[model samples]
Target: MNRELPVFIRSLPLVLAGWVFAPLIPAHATELPLLFSDGAVLQRDQPLPVWGWAKPGSQITVTFDGGTAKTHASSSGEWRVELPVHAAGGPYELSVAERGGETLRVRDVLVGDVWLASGQSNMEFPVAKAQNARAEIARAGDAGIRHFKVPRSWSDKPEPRLAGGYWRAASPGNAGDFSAVGYFFARELRTRDSRVPIGIVDSTWGGSAIEAWMSAGMLGADATVAAEKIRAKGAAAAQAATQTRARIAAWNTAPPSPEAWAAAALEESGWAGISVPAQWETQGYAGMDGVAWYRKSFELSAPETKGELTLGLGQIDDSDRVWVNGQPVGGMDASWNVPRVYRVPAAALRVGRNTIAVQVTDLGAGGGMAGSAEQLYLRAAGGPLRSLAGEWKFRTADVRLSSTQDDINQVDTALYNAMIRPLQPYALRGTIWYQGEANAYPGAAFRYRDLFASMIRGWRADWSAPQLPFLWVQLAGFHSGGDTAGESPWAVLRESQSAALALPATAQALAIDIGESNDIHPRNKQEVGRRLALAARAVAYGESLVHSGPVFRAATFDDTKARITFDLQHSALAVRGGGRAVHGFELSGADGHFHPAQALIDGGAVVVSSEAVVQPQALRYAWNDDPKQADLINRDGLPASPFRAERTRATLPQQTKQETR
Candidate 1:
């Protein structure tokens, strides 16, 4: 591979990723930020920035594409030079040198459309971890797509740059660790225009809150939402969680010892048989909660056990602790969507049959491992790969709800100061967000409408693009997509997400149909990426396209029914899979209790009315955590955005409404 020309980049596998190793600045020397690295793709047709740190009062000079720029370092050692806007074509080098400062060289940088993809786990979900990743990875060689993964850090004050990270090109070796949503987004865009390069910066953290990504200045600017800063999570949850931790800790060391359930030679005659990689509930442990133990025995010859092995345990719901041959190898807590890849030392394995014991703690939903059998396997270092997903013995250890890990990232500006501010003025074409689950439960969702909007404004202001195209994913149907005919916080959060679309150059992608009933983080991220691409095409690229599905606009009521009109690109509203009727419509009269209603598509509107509601006052569509049958889609195959049309407040229930000062 030529060092001067950008080539396809394939990183080490997922089990060996997330550790960033890149260039850093030295004292009294001019150095580039982590964002400026080999294979970096700068936003074209926009004023580009060449910024970095140097000695105070130093004269800094930046040269790029035969253009020259100069600036003086401030008292705080910060300096920057703006590169005049240029066309979208580059395989160029940028050099920075100071009269009395260190010199730096950034190579193989491309000029193109740059998008910042941020949010929680689903957005951070990688292409290799997504569904059909194997096929995608096998053919995932695209030089036009570049990615810069921002390392995670939090601070009280704005940092000049990230600690360590680098720009990597999209290739099979490294593409799996790249954001699935981001990869698909760029892939779709590049397919439309191969000449234009697409650069996606993934600055995401799993389980992060919206408040964590909003600057304090922006949070303070919004008087309505700024007050929510004081609403930090309760200490009781933390205290109780600590106490529970102490108990669990003591129980683990209480002996009989750890071998009572872990020993390779231990008897398993009394344990029930269950398959690995499937939820226990489906295998006769239905609706059961608490800690459960799963043990499996596999034969490994002496040679096979001589070298270290990589254990691919997909994802364990909630938390898990694993042991091999009575030796504690590894475990994780709370962060469920992260695939478990443990490096098993050769010392932990021996000739003949070995026992693998896993204690899965189910805090919510159900216990056991949650993944397909195909994803559970073992690959010996430089050796053959074997499956570990056959019959296993399972026994319930406890049946109590585990303590919840209180969120510290919810601290007002902690995340924003550390994650967003440092990348300020990075010149982004737009942003894509996937969040709100944290703010969706326990009385915080009602305030998300304002907070979410403030976050967008704050990020845009930081980027210096007021009308930046912002696209977000509506919370997918959850809780099994079952009918929950009661007030739901997730539904409110989705509504809050929809509320942000009122902002200029913003769009929402409806995904009520693609969610997993048992899993909050859906693996079908290809659709998510494609939907966001549609939004980018319409809002960012200025294309006349049907990028969105039907959206509920207003409701016109009558004596016996409510003719609910909708807003869409066209008046062609139909079910997603060739069905005539759509579900998830609820109607309410003066009584205010919503009931499932018969929904009929009349032109661009979905006429909804319940037999019980003779005089309808309100109508709602797809207003539940998991609306499994909410299949109303437009001609472009986009699902309708969830909405609620409430004209009167007198009949509205008090439990569903929270008044924030």
Candidate 2:
């Protein structure tokens, strides 16, 4: 057998060797994974691992940047070669060649810091939707910054390769689809070090939970069991999804004639009662994906009907077609977070008993009218706004027989199996995460403490980087402000996120001040990116600058006052608005009931006192779902994280009997 023979000639020996050896020679041609395609960015200053597929036992060689490495393909036809470490510069080419087989070459490859950005909707939010997106996109022409977005997928087990993806450089056309947080993070990094190329790998899914990104080994026994149960129904779930999509298609192409369901004259005896301004999943329609109908009736005076009116439907998930008294008013699709407002013509309204019906189609996850009570209203000319927040007649137009399509991304390890597992051991400078909104449910929020920490540790283990720097954005403020502060699930979830800092090289960026009360997805991603870069500078780059605001250190309780101290280094505690008084502080006495407290900065410490409490035993700051007025920041202008502290009663300074009196 000649050594330089063609692939077919070389395979003749294997074919004659036996059927057992024939399986080793891959049926397909030699190829590289999507990550190693053109325009890819490899992590610099580390051993570069290049991999691809070829005939089993085939000799493989990888060449890059004046260096070469050789290896042999495994029994599974997989081959990997490690090239010598390179510095942070390249627009070079990487080539993989198999003896007697095809040779693959990737162009425009760079060696630099590669950061993985992963999480839920916030991380997936595109640059086009961010604040000042148009200006940012126009200025996004940096060739040194690149992005690789992992396509959404799920599997029952670990996948050997990604479903599909491509590395795109930062430009006006490509940057709009880039993750806003990721784009800004990479942009800031390149600004700091222009000579070093920066790459961001974005792997995210909206409305996904933290557990969905973790492997079964990283999850608890109960969670693993639950995920297994879901996995058992994989085939049925797929069938249901296919059937449901067909049904939705049939309904969309051939809808009911005249849409009689939207008419005010339609009988409501068969419809079920459902509340507006909320997702249908939270109501009785959990785990349903497809179309649903909601109809609301309201009365109006003759003068109100005569004037042109505005119908505010708040936000609808996925898509919606709205009608006023059987007359189509408006429709929108794709933007689930945007509020929906329709104009009702004077002729479309009646003197009384007018009906507003909406047909909502949710491709997956949450559905129906999802908004705050204040966002649902009807405003008539020269009149006060009327509330449309009460119960409405609801009916299922179409739904998936199986709940799999709606809940697959939420299953434990499902996303990890497809989106994360295949990227293992890829050299990364660090990771940035923005999640927890999905895990803010009552029990899940509290359990996030252990789960989050374990997930970070598991990822580090997967990459063999014991000290991998992990940074995350704390859960931002949400919900309408009121007395809903005492026990907030969002606040608890934030605490869980902060608790993960107990791990080494871990940092958190506080976003409690930047969140929108009505919208879960905030557009102030610029600030979020800036804060994350600051953390990266301190943790990843070993910078001495202060990256975080004041953190609570200790607290002392005297007769009528509770003095609180903070761990402030290279910076001093200050009120955000230049006010001498500090807000967002609460005090509790022996009864364990918290009341608003007045806080005054006394030198380096804050002295808190409340007339409502005699002897303060506990203190809480920014402890609400929406801490709108929590205005405490360090001299660096970063907001302090929300916290709760209990007074050490044993360490309290004994007061004289008269002082107690």
Candidate 3:
């Protein structure tokens, strides 16, 4: 063999030597993974991976900014090459090419620190949907900043790659859909180091649980879906169970007219056209139950539809059945939280036009495609990828399926399998999470302690960053003033979130002050973002600034009053309101009846006394669902987290405690 022979020519000797090999690379060769496209930001000061599918065993090379990395494609067609650390700067081009194959050039790739912003509805709350989005949207242009939203995709099993997605640059047009917390965080990071290009990977799901974000290995067999469902508080579980049983019974008794409904030739003139990636509630069909059908049409050229294909519809709420070109392809009976990735055999696809029909049945919560708009797509089985988001026709019957809605939020590791797993192995500077409302279900708060800590541990292990700086937002204030503070589940949940601080290099972005009583998704996400940014400075960037409010470190009590000490450094304790009396304190006697206490600040400590609490044995601060006046601060403008003293007997929710009894 000639020394300068091409990869294919050099491999001829191995083939003649009777070496077993995978199928040869197609004419269309190499490609970057879903997260490695245009405007993607590589983590700075870390090895940058440029990975994708290449010809099996083919030589692949990635070149960027005066550096190059090379590797051979594995038998499975997977190939990866790591470039040396590239500092924070780029409008540079990333070129990935395969020997004797195709080339991919990702334009506007930047070398910068990357952070994963995640959690439930609050984190997913977009800038456009934020309180002051219009003003923010008007000024939302920063080419240096980019966002890669891992379109919501939940799975039962871990996926090697995202079906299809891309990195979107921040702009007036795109920022509206970007996570307000994430966008605001990135924007503030610009203030600290404007020169460092920043990228935010917004991977969040509205109304999702902390468990849904953990991997299967972390959750184990018979996952949280089975375990937590047993501990599910409130009447929703029983109602859903009843409705599900009846729905299944009715379906088994008489299947609906699905054939006619899935027919491609059916006229849908009366059907309403709606966006694919939006929830039905937001799409004007709130509180909808029973069944609905959605259809979208896309084109495929002569050569394009010949090969095997895959359809990525992100994730749907409740249940869904999919059809391609009037032929049934696949479906999930109860996969409310899992992403839909259906494989379409070549025979099912036509050469020119294609129709994708999805029939969804929602028993509860939000409906329709509850996943990301970015993840919906049609891609060649092992080749080029395409986007299948945008418009689709939807129709629903007036009949309600049942009195209960599906508990999709409890799906086991569904979000982790689809969204988090694929992004793994991508370097991360750290993660910022905003969640916990979902875990406030009665007795669920106690369970949150172990699960929350486990999630942080597993995520760190997954990212290969043992000491990764993980920052989270404590549950914000909500509901009426916790007059029944002892029994509020929200209070307990916040305590569990604080318990995770036991882990190192972790901080909580105190949100007890920024929360709204009437709204779970508060409009003051700017403060939330700013507080998180402050934590990044101290915990992640090692800055010498105060990033947290006063945290309850220890409590000492005299026969009459209690003094609470906090972990503080250069910062001093202040009453936050012109030295006014501090609120959100409670004192309990041996009888365990907690009474509102009068609190005042005294040199890094909060002194509290309650006239009603004689011989105070316990103390609590901000111990309520919504402490309207929990205004303790550390002069840093950051608010203190809600806390309950050990001496105080924490009350469980009335209904929950009674039920447990």
Each candidate's number of clashing pairs is 6, 0, 4
Give the number of colliding residue pairs in candidate 1: 6
- Quote each prediction's TM-score: 0.73, 0.82, 0.70
Model 3 Cα shift for residue 412 (angstroms): 1.1
lDDT of 1 by residue, 533-638 (tens): 9999999999988888887677777777777666777547888777567788888877878988988777776777778888888777777788786888888778
Top candidate by lDDT: 2
Evaluate model 1: give its lDDT: 0.74
In model 1, the clashing pairs are 10-174, 11-174, 30-102, 128-176, 478-625, 481-626
CA RMSD, predictions in order = 11.7, 10.2, 17.8
- Segments of candidate 1 deviating more than 4 angstroms: 1-25, 221-261, 264-406, 480-484, 647-661
lDDT of candidate 2 over 1-661, digit per residue (tens): 0000011111011010000011133585687878888999999888877787788899998889878899999998888887878899989999888888788899999999999999987888888878999999999999899999987667667677777789999999889889899999888888789998999999887767888899888985464575575566565455554543443343332237538787778877867788888887666554455567899988889888787899899888867999989999999865576788888999998987899989887755667888789889999866899999989887766554322344566778888877888787678999999988877866677778889999999999998999989999998787733224346667777878888988999988888989988667788898888889989999999988888888777788877888888877678888988966999999999997899999988877888999999988888888888888798888788888887777774221222232222
What digit string (tens of lDDT, one per residue) describes model 3 on residues 1-661?
0000011111011110101122244554676666788888988999876678877899988899879888899998888777898788888898888888777888888888899998887888778757788999999988877898766554445667764457888899889888889989888898899998889998876667877787656766575554354234224434444443443332222125787767767777867778878777555553345567888887777676678888998878756888888889988754455678999888888877788888886644567786776679888755677887888887774323322122344566766766788888888889999988877766677678778988999999987888898999888887733335347778778888888888998988877777776557677888888989998998999999888888777887888888888877578777766775898788888887789899988887888999998899877777778877788888777778887774443322223452132
Please, what is the whole-model Cα lDDT of each candidate in the order they appear? 0.74, 0.79, 0.74
- Which structure is stronger by TM-score: 1 or 2? 2
Q: Which residue pairs overlap in candidate 3's backbone?
A: 154-339, 363-405, 364-405, 364-406
For candidate 3, what is the total of clashing residue pairs?
4
